[model samples]
Target: MFCFQCEQTAHVNGQAGCASTKGVCGKDETTADLQDLLIYQLKGIGQLSERLRALGKPDQAADSFTLYALFTTLTNVNFNRAVFTGLIAEAARIRDRLRDALAAAGGDVSGLSAAVSFQPATDLPGLLAQANIASVRAGLDLVGEDVIGLRALILYGLKGVAAYAHHAEVLGEARDEIYAGVAHALAFLATDPDDINALLAEALALGRLNFTVMEVLDAANTGRFGAPVPTQVLTTPVAGKAILVSGHDLRDLHNILEATKDKGINVYTHGEMLPAHGYPKLHAYPHLVGNYGTAWQNQQQEFAAFPGPIVMTSNCLIEPQPAYRNRIFTAGPVGWPGIRHIQNDDYAQVIQAAQAMPGFAEAAPAKTIQVGFARETVLGAAETVINAVKSGDIRHFFLIGGCDGAAPGRNYYTDFADHAPKDTMLLTLGCGKYRFNMHDHGEVAGLPRLLDVGQCNDTYSAIQIATALANAFGCGVNDLPLTLVVSWFEQKAAAVLLTLLALGVRNVRLGPSLPAFLTPTLLNVLVEKFGVQPITTAEADIQAALTRQAA
Candidate 1:
């Protein structure tokens, strides 16, 4: 159980990784090993599926399975071993079917690696037995740390891509090109390439692929929910039977809202779902109440105190404590060992749980928070923003966005946003904004000082807004008075960072700690090539960004 794919991995002496019996996220050794086995089998499916696609016989089931399976392996998404067991067997079956299809199509399949040809174990013991060789560290002695690190980067980025693509797929949006790119990237990792240069190129390629996935996701979200508009959401509780929906899946939230409509349940957004309030269709629900909590890391306490059922729709779920475990339900790719899972968009069980629990006794004092400042919303006011910048009323723009974690260093983002000068505009996205989104940033030149672009995947929106701003000023994006201060926690943030680098977007500050997988040499390469800087104190970084803009 060697897992170092997240920011909060345990650091022992000079080494960084979660090699103990349980990970920092509460994932046990058994679950971690099962996840590895699932990924290994999925890579086999990827190899066969890529070949099958090349033969003009693409399997939609294989493509969908790869997305869902890869999504489950992301940080804080799923911890149920039984779920992985089923996925492993299914992946093996899919791989065999694809192999047969490829062979029948006259595609040569004999030279494929063991990942495409190996048989999956039938039971738990056999699966555990196969894990040692299938794990990420299998060839560490021969390939070395730098090669292993690069492969992990590409693989982790692909996992992030799969998560975003799955969100888009559930919304009835998917591109064959994105699917093929995901499969090809997974299959490439299976070959265990040792060339550092080739691996780095592949990582950047994944960044480009992830950009497409995010674009598709943006389309799916806006197409289904309508473009986000600036709206004020209540932060206080509403009186009624209530259910809290967390995670990043708008489709699941939509389904839950539909199922619970007029049924007396007041739905409240939690975590990344906070941004859903800005969407016209979602906000139209009369019973869709205000946001209920902060970021995912605070779930244990928040969920325990809430007097209603809670439904997690995607990643960033910690192991449920017993206090609220029975009332908690997992949906989509999220799962816990004993927590009830909502399948096929059927949230009947969740509704039943909500009905059984005592909701808010009475409406808490109404308070509001503003959301829905995505690219369209921001660009709609482009003239005002441009004028403000030109008149020097808005001196700079700071983009403080990314995934949030429990680490103390994350407070730097809060302080940075809170302390930004009144003349500058603060832009935020992702769950990281939970740290300071609630804080008042006062207006700068008639516009809200703090603007939320959207979810982590909506880094696409941030990119678009920056590009638009650059075009408005007739300068490159890097030449604008915009700075990106990213707080990374998981693979999704890693993929976003890679995209920024791939696009030649420079002078970005990344932190809450660097990825444990990146060796010193690789880190140096990023520092030199992309001008990526480790975050300093909030005051120091803010001053530095302002200094760079002035220069």
Candidate 2:
């Protein structure tokens, strides 16, 4: 499989891969092929969405269908064979309907990719059997690295869009434009792999559309959850049966909390799920417990040591160690070859898994970990934070955000955090914070300089805070006394970077490394248009950013 959807792609040109047969992320040849097919189908649907929109007939079902399909394809979401096939079949039907409609409308779309036309039986298990046995693989050996990288980038962005769209749909909110954009993006990746300039343009376009999608998701989350507040979540799991829920789906967390309520089970957040504590609806669950582990890469050790069952809601799930294999359950899009998966969206199976596993045993509760700084909470503190800036108490604002990974170069984030100016306040979100969350960066005038604004979804908080500060200071966001130093490892981070670019946030530094997916021409466009840079030494980069701001 020639995959380069992440920063961790095997080669810079994208021709290299994690593994020739199976993915480094535990994905086998079959899964990778299925993911490609799913992307293909979604692109078809995207073409349909645009056609419908042109005809003044935006389809909610089409939008939802694309969202669900994309969500299923995201990293670590769906591994369950049966669940994936069902979604693919559903997407196929939708694609067929749209293709027929487009054809009737005299839209000569006969050259569409085979992904749109592929059919799967409605029977979930049957489809799974076919996919599992068919031995489908990416024909990447025939393509150059740059083409592979660009397509991977496109696919990853669509996955992120799918996730945001799913969150919006959860809250009864939908954006047809965003859905159409994602679908169109997928189609572009499938057909135009060789167009370097076109790929770069699409990457930027993905970024722009993602920004819109994220804003919609932000509204849905904050509106439904009553905004995030500053609160510390305990890491200790209380005594009793417990289930560790990881990944980014807050709605699933709430549902689990509801299911486990009064059932003597404790729930703890892990990885991206740690931000769940900031949500009023989620944190209100007394037995919701605390965070179980750090970022996604540490799951092997963390899950191994855990005392109970675990449920994954989204990406960053590694293959389970044998020690904890029996106790892990896949929910939503996350699936593993051998893991038990919850079906029918009922989540009853997850609850049952928690009951069967050893429940949480009594453990000592520790100091609270501070969280909750979404748009509302940060806005509430605007007066104080602003006043501090005005009084010279807060010297600099450093937005250190992006994805977390296991690569050695990732230590750059930890070192950067360690070396940042003492007076500089760190506003971070996403798994990227995994680098420095354990470090003690002493307070700055009674406030913790290293402030976490929840998960990647909460990156909106950082954006809002920047915009608000700029408005308060009567300047554009770029002119505000803030710097964006990002660390990206995957597609969601790419989406976030695009959002920053779309908003005209300039002089942003991204690392532990630049994405292998970007062609030289594509990279040049971003550098010229946005002044985005790859990270160098922390000291030098920080000094340069500050000097530029001072000038």
Candidate 3:
């Protein structure tokens, strides 16, 4: 098994990807093969779903399941081999279901490839034997590195798209086009086309598709919880029986809050869930106290120290350490073999565990940080922002954010944010902000020098703010006085980058290192075509952005 669909993939002798028994994410070869098989099966399901849709007999249930199944394959989301084994069978059943409908609808399924024709095995060894059907690195010698790299990018982007769509879907949002787009892209993958130009177009199309998915997710979030407002979140803990909610699922956090209400339990947000505090409906829960930890990578130490139960709601989970493994709970797509999982939004076990353990022993003073500078809050102050720029009070903007990792060079983001000019505003989101978010940036023209846009899930908010500012300044988004310094770790970041490229937003400096899946040739194409460049030094990149602004 070979897997390099993330920023943290193993590098052996300068060759990227983890081809050993285990991946850098701790996903063993068995798990990796199962994920590959699940994706392969999803491709078949998608092929049939696409064909059925074209015949005007779309399967909505299969579409929803497709989104959820694709999401489970995302990096750090699921590592349970049993879960993957089950999903493989479920995917096959769904594919067959779609095929039956297509057959009835007179949609020809003849002459299709194995992805659409092969049967899944009943046992683990049998399934593993068929892993070749969905090998990520197969035929690299024939198709070459660039083609394989492009295909991985598209497939990973689909994972990100599915994750976002699934979150929104669970929050009561759905679109037929989403189903069609996902199915179409998956079907496209099944053909294994090596045409570079066609593959690039499909990648960009997936990016555009993600833009709509992001919109639906944004609407789902704001509609259910009200638009995020700028609010101060306390970083210190309070005295009570406590439960820490991590990852990006607000729905899980909300349910935890409700179940623990008046039960002597205080809920704290961690990782990407930090932005949940800014939502009116969620913040209204007084028991939902401050944040407990910094980012996902720090969870081993943090979770070990936390006294109460910890619930992981979505992605960004690392292998649970023995110190806190028993106390930790996985929900939604999150899973670890022996760890208890909370299903169906039921928080009884979580609440009971929180009640059973010791929480924070003492209440600390509110050490607050500003959050929720989303599209609404940012655009509401557009007049002030515009005036600040016109009056030379704000020189530029730097969006220094994305998933943070334990890798060495992550300091680039912190340094980039720290070394940014005082006149420039720093816009951040996701766990990457934890690097320098606590720094006092002072105020630029009555606005804080740093603004927290939100979680990575709220990337739509960042894009919206950029578009609004561009429109206000009467220029293309590329022409705006802004720089995007993105630190990506997983597939969601891949999707975000694709969305930016598809929107034609240029000069995004991505680091801590380029994706291993990207062969040098593919990286060159991105650099030449999209102005994508790897991060150099903070001071140097900062000077470069300023120079571009001056020119």
Error of 3 at 103 (Å): 0.8
Query: What Cα-based lDDT does every candidate model obtain?
Result: 0.91, 0.76, 0.91
**Candidate 2 Cα misplacement greater than 4 A, ranges:** 11-15, 80-87, 103-151, 187-200
TM-score versus the correct structure, for each prediction: 0.99, 0.90, 0.99
Q: Across residues 1-551, which tens digit of lDDT does each residue of candidate 3 receive?
A: 99999887888897888999998888999999999998988888888988888888888999998998888889899899999999888888888888888888888888566788779899999999999868988778889989999999999999999999999998999999999999999999988889999999999999999999999999999999999999999999888898999999988888888888788888999999999999999999999888988999999999999999999989988999999898899998889999998878888888888888888899887799989899999999999999999999999999987999989998888888888888999999989999999989899999999999999988899999999999998999999999999999999999999999999999999999889888889999999999998999999999999999899
Which is the winner by TM-score between candidate 1 and candidate 2?
1
Tens digits of lDDT, candidate 2, 1-551: 44556765565353545546766666666566666556656766776677667777667788887777777766656665555566677777788888777777777676766556667656644454445322212444666656666667667776777787787787777777776787678667656467767876787788888877778888888777777878788866677887889988777787788878798788899999887788888788899778888999889999998877788888888888999998888876678877887765677766777778777666775856778877677777788888888888887888888889887788878888899888788888998887898688888756778788888877766777888888999999888878898888776777787777767888899888777667676577678988988889888888887898789
TM-score of candidate 3 on Cα atoms, chains taken together: 0.99
How many pairs collide in each candidate, listed in order? 0, 10, 0
Q: Show pairs that collide, candidate 2.
A: 15-145, 77-333, 77-334, 78-333, 78-334, 79-335, 232-369, 240-360, 241-359, 241-360
lDDT score, candidate 3, position 294: 96
Please provide the root mean square deviation of candidate 3 (C-alpha atoms, Å). Answer: 0.9
